[model samples]
Target: MERLDGARGPRSPDRRGLPARGLRRGHPPAHRRERPGDHARDRGLGIALSPGFLSAFVFPSFRRLWIGAFLSSIGTWTQDVALSWLIHTRIGDPFYLGLRTFASELPLVTFMLVGGAQADRVDRRRILLVSQVFQMSMAGALGVLYGLERLGIGAILVIAFLTGLAQSQSAPTYQATLTSLVPHDHIPNAVALNSLQFNLSRAIGPVIAGLLLARVGTGACFAANVLSFVAVIVAIARIELPPVAALGRESLGQSLKAGIRHVVESPILSALTLLGATASLLAFPLITFLPVLAGDVLHTGAPGYSLLLTSLGVGAIAGAVTTAHRGSVPGRGKLMLLAFMACGAATVGAVLSGRQWLAMALLAAAGFSLTTAFSTLNSLVQEHAPNELRGRVLSIFGLAFRGGMPVGSLVAGGLVNAFGAPAVLAAFASALFLIAAAIRLRNARLRAL
Candidate 1:
């Protein structure tokens, strides 16, 4: 049987006598023959290639997931900000706040391989559903505690840990599921769209959380988060995705070894992942210090903290939008290198700024570079990985991206405690940018590939 692209209508059996899967007789494969001018044979040197970027928005499956996830992410951000504030207010310790972040992210580093293996072995939708339910339950518990005024730092930390575990389990499956939603031709666009939704939510979520925090109590933010999960659950329940058959039937350990081997063998993926991991390890931890930046350095309190978070979200949204418009331009190696440099520059700018507005602007720039680099790397990994091993590869990708945060938070917190926020920020920014530049220069294949 020959598979036909559904976008161009039905396909009919040709002289080769292949059976068309879902097409009417007497028609060629939709994707086999291109219309006049469809293929870019020649163009001016400066002309940009447009790869039908709008098709991503038209794909129903991806559209549903994007919208649903966006709504849910807003709630997730609200809950995150509220929880961070709650912990700080209740415990009054940056170390504990750092530890809370560590507890939530540490599981990803440890269990991401297993999670990826599971995503490859089982139905991704089911895995997502299970994880969502677990996360929702935790959110509900926190909401209840908040409503009753019984929420304590310890309870919040424990719940955060559980939610982190669920996130670790869910992320690989979610990443892998994107490929199943659209035709292979649209995978890049789908990935970009996914990033767009996430960044969009990031931009808007903090603003909403800020407003909510200013009006209602932080408990209400948790409650709102509890409601957000419902959108994702319903969206997943309604999606009719392509069947994903199990492949490369091997033990979890063997599969993990295979993924690691593939990464080692593929220098481009390895370089990108390493650069991403290093950047994440150094720069991403500053987020855990935002509350402190607001309280001590800026003297703005919770509302100021909220604005700082929102600014980063807005920057991320801008990055995602830029990527969407660009439509997977090649040379991600250089782009990633530049993004890291931009991130480092932004971080340095942020540290040097004494004014709250200037700090927010710098943080926003950093957010843009951070999201762009991370999202580009994510798409690159997905594009390069074999279909069977994609889940595991992406799980590793998630681990590198997320797992670094906990370690970064701990280091950042300790540095802040010992020296100051500015010193830690400066050290992290300088080290990360320098390392990224060194890596790019050391690996020629990474730049060429």
Candidate 2:
């Protein structure tokens, strides 16, 4: 079978029957189109990249970015766990936990669109470079504060907010760049590989952070995260891209409106946004509250918290790797629906399970399902949107993806205090399952996708 770009029709495979090659100058990138037939469906789900799943990797720029992103992700996961543990042990309140999560995400909601607009208007590589520097400084500052034993919850929140703001600038640029690095035909492969890198880092970073926290302290993980940014910076410096031709500049307000209008007008984008938002709001809150569960319900210390995070990451890795290998699966809408249900089911199981290992296992299952579903959706969004609007389209995705998780975390943080973590999680998980089923039943077009 030949590889298919969800847009721009079927790609001609090379002598070895792999997608001919990745994006290069002289050859314009594939334009966007709505995939409405079985062939379109196959492009969405049945991406048949043979001669191995690493075909996109044949492109030097993408491979460099891929490796760089993977290293950077590992550092991020390490810092994330360490920070959560620090806040949990230091603040010792569920409200603070939620507050911390909110602080991290509030910046994304506020600045993501602006960032997306900037990505469209400027050199994405420069955006990444500046953001990486900003984030590295924040991480280093946190490490120093922690080492001095002077970091308060307020300071922690401040730094988290700052780092998230930098992320807002970087994420859309990075995401939009992936499209440029590979030809349209290999997009699904690129998206899956990126997810695979993320989950693999997620799987390992926490365990490493766990060990460091158990023995050395949080400072080590923070310092490691600082170096990780440098790795990505260097990678960006080394990879060369063609000079972007100037487009007619729009005012910031106009650019913002244009991006939002695109998403609002596209049914598939709107529907996917709805599902991702709901799931993030009701179901993904579990991630923000996992440390609380570790401490209150399981009575495990930092080690237990790390183990729990590692379990989820491990499951996510499995899911990402499977998707990367399979290339595609038919009926993506149904896959997302199933994945959403599985996440809720797993959360329910975790809520009921009293034992730590059992809870970890269930969380792992939930992670697997959630990652698989979202990665597919991510690919779809990347494929469906026109190249000109890629940054803006993905920014809308970033808003839904990062924006909802924090607000949910904030709410869950307070709700857990009132109703207990177990009860709060169970209630929301049930709600999520019902919502998913209802959408599946009502939206035939969603199913067709």
Candidate 3:
């Protein structure tokens, strides 16, 4: 059955498709670093797990790390909103707007696999430290450039790409190590809590940026974000994790290949990847053109733009809470299906609505659906992947999560300039509905969850 001595043979697959060694103590996966407290948790030794969200926070280390991550995410959203507003208002070009989105996400597709392999082989904390430093520098540069009136679209894109590159390198490591700070039973709650922090920041950051954008300026938002990186770097240093056993490292290519092979063999994992990629490529690009939506349709100026983004964030937070509570529910695929249909309906309704308030309401619905679909997909990967392959699997998830947005954005950006945001959005929304239906019907694995 299960062994803790780090030696084992392949066991039979469970419903989750987790590898045999995954449940054992055989060769340590990238993320499994055994510690004293963990040994106790594993053996159910003198510990009681709390119900719902409270359980994840019982560990002092996880709570501190969550706080830091929340602060950093808020800063990131602040910078993102400020930068997009600056590009749209100053340059007034939809193509550049699309290019900006593309630059930021491109590295996620290209470098994330290597980053995943690195997480398995190297010190994850070091990776986070380096990435944070690069992001801090980039934010500082943006603020300086804006203050000096030297900021241009080209320079902005380059900075965005560099910061994105840094994020791509560090995210897999951070995600892989997430469960290390908590007991095995709390991983679901932990993941849900992590989503909550991000979505909360998503809502709050844009609202704060909106106020600053109209009053002080974009530079102020950028400056605030620059300071936020400090929290994450400090958190990483303060949290002491279990000692990771030393193991021989694999070459980057071989390591990546192994990860790819794992996904290829796993039916459920492949379905999850397709689910995210389709949503990203088709449904998400519409989100990038929010500036155009406000300016052209609503004519509500900066405040209207801000409110629309806030609605999305608010809805996302609701979705995260629902997911957190659904941890005990076994039907992930069924939930994702309902959410996808809702997302499609909401997108179409938002596009067609003539009034600003109605559009915002519809977008909130879309936001809720988006979180449900993606987060459920994410949880599937975490549950099914073994500890050693966790980073690589999550990296593939990250790749699917991020890769399609740029291609869609770039395409939509050009078409928006020619036809308009509404026409392009409507076209993609229709395509997304059809794609979801086809994929859902064909993949029994996705339907069954």
Candidate 4:
């Protein structure tokens, strides 16, 4: 057995009178040893006794929050599918689709810094609750408008913008809350579980949306999302959070500047943010253009598109699970870089594939690699962030993660119009791969991290 400090336990004599390397002599194995808060604490649930992918659930608070968030995320994905389909069918223009997506994400990139600053100054739980309420109301309004046959593209865009605005507030607080829910050592597992739930929903939600759209129309999808917020709100209210140390009030401008300065000054933060944003800009746009690949290249239409998306989601879930299982394993920085390179390579392969099966397999591999790289990066960010500035730091990270996708999509769309999807996407993937390699070669310290 190995101790927490990476030392082997004392060995005992075997039947042949030889010291057995695998057998511990004097004490129980490391996991059997008790630590603080080992007993049942919340709703009669005890801490998980063994280490694995599910280790983060040992904390009741994290478990509750995760379950609630997972449920809500599924509903959100359902709405996303239904809304996208509705826009595409109604508008019959890719421009409107791109516009809607851009409108939705713009607030997140622009206003989340303010939200992060406020998260540091106020109660995070309250911020989360209020955001949920705002989102729920927007969802309800969408359902009502659609049901009344008054839903227009402009109204949808406005609602989408408002919904994203609410998310801008909740996203940073949600990221920072993970630190309070689990011990510092378990942060990797927590972050992995977070990614796992989101990807799992991605795999499941679209199918549900499809069924609802066929049988009951888009209103049902919107209504389901509205109801989903109740679960997270209740969970947030019931869980007990540790009191935060008071941070003296600072102007939002000062707070934003401080956060940006910190990220710019720290070599690790700067590299991580740059790499993450680059991936978003280059690799993630593949997802935005998957429909083009499905229709123009593969001639597989909607069903094939759905299958490709499912493969991506399933692979991402696997990646998150693997990261969680590894926990705080050493050499994560090296592993992250390898995954980043692998994702780019797999995406390139997928774009060049002539057969649907080959494309699907490569896409799956790309998804797995991308999620592994991203989750590891997220874990490192959380580990390094100070408590007082954690929300702001994470918000900056969130911007890098999300803000690039829309711009990338627009650029890739224009390029696709000129050169075609396969050629353009392949070039982007190659760029991603080469960039990651260059970063790896130049930064020996990053490899050591």
Top lDDT hit:
2
Q: In model 1, which runs have C-alpha deviations exceeding 4 angstroms?
A: 1-53
The alpha-carbon deviation from the true structure for residue 54 of candidate 3, after best TM-score superposition, in angstroms, is 3.7
What tens-digit string does per-residue lDDT give for candidate 1 at 11-97? 011111221223233554323332323333322223333546445544444555666777887788788888887777777778877
The estimated TM-scores of all candidates read 0.86, 0.88, 0.87, 0.87
Compared with the true structure, all predictions reach lDDT values of 0.70, 0.74, 0.73, 0.73
- Going through the candidates in the order shown, the clash numbers are 1, 1, 2, 0
Per-residue CA lDDT of candidate 2, range 214-277, in tens? 8888899999898887667766775544344355867878888988999999999988877777
- Supply the TM-score for candidate 1: 0.86
Task: Give me the runs in candidate 3 sitting further than 4 Å from their true place.
Answer: 1-50, 243-249
The positional error of residue 164 in candidate 3, measured at the CA in angstroms, is: 1.2
Tens digits of per-residue lDDT, candidate 4, 14-70, equal 111111123234533222232445424434564544567777676656666777777
Query: Which residue runs of candidate 2 sit more than 4 Å off their true CA positions?
Result: 1-52, 242-245
| Candidate 1 Cα RMSD (Å) | 8.4
